[model samples]
Target: MIIVPASADTERGRPGTTQQFADMQAYNDQMLRAGVFVDGQGLHPTSRGARVTWADGEWSVTDGPFAEAKELIAGFTIIEVSSREEAIEWLKKWPASCAPDPGQHLELRQVYAPEDFGEEFTAELREREEQMREEAARAAARG
Candidate 1:
């Protein structure tokens, strides 16, 4: 997962230019051609979203815009690559104009596969997980 955090300009609800979006689309196309792009999406600003938090054995919903811009995610990209280095190489090609100014950063996090959990993750569990994923894909396709 490539986590795009909200920048200062993003927190202010600044929108990307048409050219920037075109550039980003081109970048995404390139990644798709390279067979590394699994899925990706850009997000609207924090003002249009909400957060749900659990505290003191209860749940609370808070409306945006959230005060901590840096802690908020603006978007995400999921890539399928053989190595971390390959993923970083793809990240390096991110379109500069597509993101906000002043400060911008993307975080990389590895998604855990069932194998990563070792023997405790039983074969039945793995099979069930795979089935669930297949069902989800089918549902999405139907939609």
Candidate 2:
């Protein structure tokens, strides 16, 4: 998962230009052709969202637009690669299409598979997870 930390445009609720979308689509198409791109999407600004927090056994809700732009996520992309280096190589190609600014940065994170948790992720858990995923796929297909 590549996390796109928030930018000024996201905080300000500014929309991207048509050319930016076209450029990104071209890059995404290339990745799709290479069989690396699995999924990707952009998010609306924080002004339309909310946060629910649990702390000290208490629950609280905070409405946006949130103040901390750097901590928010404006978008994300998921890719499958054999190594971190390969992921970085793909990341390097992103900026060319993204029209990034000097302050813009992205975070690369590996998604955790059930195997990563070792025995703590028991067989029962894996089975349940697989069942859920299948159900989700079926629901999507129905739609």
Choose the strongest candidate by lDDT: 2
Q: What lDDT score is found at residue 7 in candidate 1?
A: 73
What's the C-alpha lDDT at position 2 in model 2? Answer: 90
Local distance difference test, each candidate: 0.84, 0.85
Most accurate candidate by TM-score: 2
Q: How many backbone clashes can be found in candidate 2?
A: 0
Identify the runs in model 2 with alpha carbons over 4 angstroms from their true place.
97-99
Query: Could you tell me every candidate's TM-score relative to the true structure?
Result: 0.88, 0.93
What lDDT is obtained when candidate 2 is compared to the true structure? 0.85
Candidate 2 root-mean-square deviation in Å: 1.4
Q: What ranges in model 1 sit over 4 Å off?
A: 12-15
Across residues 1-143, which tens digit of lDDT does each residue of candidate 2 receive? 99887778866776466787888888889999999999999998999999999999999999889987768898899999999999999988984646445676878999998899999899999999999999999999999
User: Residue 17 CA error for candidate 1 (Å)?
Assistant: 1.5
Estimate, for each residue in 1-143, the C-alpha lDDT of model 1 and write its tens digit: 89888776666676566897799889989999999888988778888888899999999998888887768887888999999999999889989876544565788999898889999999999999999999999999999
